[model samples]
Target chain A: MKFLAEINVMPQKEILDPQGKAVKIGLQNLGINQVSDARIGKHIQLQLEAGSEAEANQIVTDACKKLLANIIMEEFEFKLIQL
Target chain B: MKFLAEINVMPQKEILDPQGKAVKIGLQNLGINQVSDARIGKHIQLQLEAGSEAEANQIVTDACKKLLANIIMEEFEFKLIQL
Candidate 1:
């Protein structure tokens, strides 16, 4: 089976997202001032070959923990959908 | 009402994502070879003040169309959750 993992990797709440802040400021400058607390992170989409749903989830978990996300500064979560 | 908008900005499929390609190569170098078509994008989380869910959605849609995404090279989608 082929599983698609859509992952969201975000900066820890305690971590400062300079790029996010910059974008927020950019937005404010553009006169769209209603949005705040803008936080930026990464969205990763990957396809994997797995025998079962559990295996696909496990592979994604490992990929997130070991490669896709930087745990020291960022946190991650994902949704799996078969494609 | 306070609402949270979770947005994903991704490179258009026809566009080349060098950073994403680099990350995929990095993964293979780390011995994770089961993954393919690795793509990278931005995850944006923001809080907004809106009178209703529909209003909030409009605000987010405008944000995505105007500032958060580059339509020529990237595409964006979002979900709004009340908080």
Candidate 2:
């Protein structure tokens, strides 16, 4: 079976996103007064071959833990679908 | 009223994602052979004040068009929620 993992890795709420803050300042300078806070993160999609759904999900989970995300600074969530 | 916009900007399918390609190679080297293709993108969350839902949505759309995404290489989609 082939599967796709749609992953979202977001900075922890307590963490300061400097890039986002910089963009926020830019927006404010543009007179977008309504804008308050902006947070930026990463979106990733992975395609893989697996023997079963469980196996595919497990692989994705392992990937997130080891390489895809930094657990202390960012958190990851994913949805798996057969492709 | 306060609103939140959750936005995702992804590399177009026709675009080659070099970063994703690099990550895929690394994953393969780690023996994660099942991994075939990987695509990376951005996720953004914005907070704003608006008079109405329609206005909030419009503001988010404009932001996406002007600052949040590069239209030639990426595409964006967003969801708006009242806060």
Candidate 3:
């Protein structure tokens, strides 16, 4: 089966996100003061072929651990759907 | 009321994603050949104050148009949840 994985890699909450902070400031500067905070991260979409759903899950998890996310500073989660 | 918006800004399909291509090559180098393609984009979370859901939606849509997305090179979508 073919599957698509939508992965989100986000900085750990305890870590400071300079990019997000900058975005918040930018928004405020644009006169959008209602925004209290912003957090920025990566959205990765993967297209892969797998024999089954379980196999697809395993592949995506390994990809996240090995390449997609920096476990030390960022965490990742993904939803896999058959395509 | 307060709302949180989970936004994704992605390169338009016609555009090339060098970052994602790099990731795909890296994954293949690591022996993960099942992945056929990859695309990387931005994930942003915004925490904001609004009077109602409709108002919050308008605020977020405006943010996307004015700043969050380039509109020319990329496209964006977001989900807003009351907090």
**Per-model C-alpha lDDT, please?**
0.89, 0.91, 0.95
* Residue pairs that clash (backbone atoms under 3 angstroms), model 1: none
Name the top TM-score candidate: 3
Name the DockQ score for candidate 3: 0.90
Per-residue lDDT for A4-83 in model 1, tens only?
89999999999888988987888888777778779999999998788899988988898899888989999999999998
Q: What's the lDDT for residue B58 in model 3? A: 91
Of the candidates numbered 1 and 3, which has the greater lDDT value? 3
DockQ of each: 0.80, 0.79, 0.90
Kindly report which residue stretches of model 2 are placed more than 4 angstroms away from their true locations once superposed: none
Give one digit per residue, the lDDT tens place, for model 3 in A1-83.
99999999999999999999999999988999999999999999999999999999999999999999999999999999999
> Model 2 residue A6 lDDT?
90
Q: How many residue pairs clash per model?
A: 0, 0, 0
Ranking by TM-score: 3, 1, 2
The candidate with the higher DockQ, 1 or 3, is 3
Which segments of candidate 1 are over 4 A away from where they belong?
Answer: none
RMSD of each: 1.2, 1.4, 0.8
Candidate 3, CAPRI quality class derived from DockQ: high
What is the Cα-based lDDT of residue A60 in candidate 1?
88
